[model samples]
Target: MFKISRRKSVNLSIAVALSFIAVVAVIAVLIPFAWENTPYFSKLVNDVVINESQQLGRCVFFVWLYICFAIVEACCVMVFVLLIRVRKGLVFSEISVDCLRYISWLCMLLSLFLFVGEIFHPLMFVMAMAVVFLGLCLRVTKNVIELATSIKQEHDFTI
Candidate 1:
């Protein structure tokens, strides 16, 4: 049994997510150096589909990677905040809905960016589709949260 107290669990999740963001930030900053020094990756980055049939340059590919990583970090931050709200007993608040909405939009933004990247790289096509699907699911979840918030407000008023 993996039973754990809710507060401890929430704190652990938040810590893990923050750690992930930090690690991703560090990796994103070192991406250029990594691509330059890693022999196999350097070759792949330079000799991939870009120079052949794709119009995107090496700089553009790096830019795409940075943007995607930024979006992921942003999403993780939002999730962290949302979990905090849950811990604070604001589970059905409008703020939570707004946070969810922003996350959904972020997902869509990542999807659009990946779609453009996919036009040239072709490898990003699956990732783009997956992000778009994630955005759609988040939108649905936001709606559900919004409804619950409204119902809770009404119930509170009646009480």
Candidate 2:
């Protein structure tokens, strides 16, 4: 019989979530391009643009969607790496700090992207605010981990 610890289960859950996000991000990136020639997509472009430059609007929309998905995919990869480090008991290591720092930056970038998107759709402001909050929380988590690593090294040297 095999036993799974609570911590391991939590880590596994996080890994699964991150994987799911990555999969969804890939799908999102693909769907826009795949449906670019579809009638529904053309109608959507016409509706959104309400101008004669529907083709240009469609192109811009695809590019923006791809950029968003790329950022999300990058964030998912960073989180997966961080979760792997946690599973390996390397939470206090420099690699973990780097992962956290990068994730924080990604969150900030996502927030900014959403903020700009809000100019076209006001509802995106809520998502932008949420990403900003998540970024701040990740930044604090990174600082705390850095501080703990420093304290651990100091204690080890003293002993």
* lDDT, model 1: 0.85
Q: TM-scores, in order shown?
A: 0.86, 0.82
Ten-residue stretch with the least lDDT total in model 1: 48-57
Best by TM-score: 1
What is the C-alpha lDDT profile of model 1 across 1-159, one tens digit per residue?
989999999889989988998999999888778876787554545566536532355666777778889899999999989989988989899899999999999999999998887644567889889999999999999999999999999999999
Clashes of each: 0, 0
Model 2: per-residue Cα lDDT over 49-113, one tens digit each: 44469777677667766777888888888888887777778888888999999999999998888
Poorest stretch of ten by lDDT in candidate 2: 43-52
**lDDT values, one for every candidate:** 0.85, 0.81
Model 2 clash pairs are: none
State the displacement of the C-alpha of residue 89, model 2, in Å, after optimal TM-score superposition.
0.4
